[model samples]
Target: MSELLDNTEAATKAVVDWLTKKAKTKSKFYIKDFYKIFPDDKPRAIKKVVNKMVETGELEFWSSGSTTMYGLKGGGIQHSSEGES
Candidate 1:
């Protein structure tokens, strides 16, 4: 049980670091973009970590009407349903 917790923590850190440090130039990404960050880890696990970040307000969802992408909160242009004239 403890080992699982440790793994989860490490995975979470890795994802955050990649988003903040490595992918700093990019603002938004598809879920599939995270798969390579943890090549040995299952894609499902990667998705789980990213989703958890989203839930915790560390990341946010950006939609372009037809598609949705993810980005760090306040890191780049955010889409909102306001001021549309």
Candidate 2:
């Protein structure tokens, strides 16, 4: 059981990593895009994992019409100093 859980975690991480990389180049990704990236897994399962990532602050979401777009947080911005702008 523990091994299964570990594999599941790894798979989820793989999906997250893939999405993060894609989002870096593109502003948004829809559910079908995820399915294309990971065709072996069901779309619903992928969405579930994505929701978990959103909850954990690893992903951010926006809605456009009937689609939900996802992207990385911070928008690739990095802060160097607190009051040294």
Model 2 TM-score on a 0 to 1 scale? 0.64
RMSD of 1: 3.5
The collision pairs in model 2 are: none
For every model in order, what is the number of clashing pairs? 0, 0
Q: lDDT of each structure?
A: 0.73, 0.63
lDDT (0-100) at residue 40 of candidate 2?
A: 67
User: Against the hidden true structure, what lDDT does model 2 obtain?
Assistant: 0.63
lDDT of 1 by residue, 2-70 (tens): 243248667677777788875558878888888877776667767777888899988887777998788
User: What is the alpha-carbon lDDT for the whole of candidate 1?
Assistant: 0.73
In candidate 2, what are the lDDT values of residues 52-77, reduced to their tens digit?
76788877777656877776654432
Error of 1 at 22 (Å): 3.5
RMSD of each: 3.5, 6.1
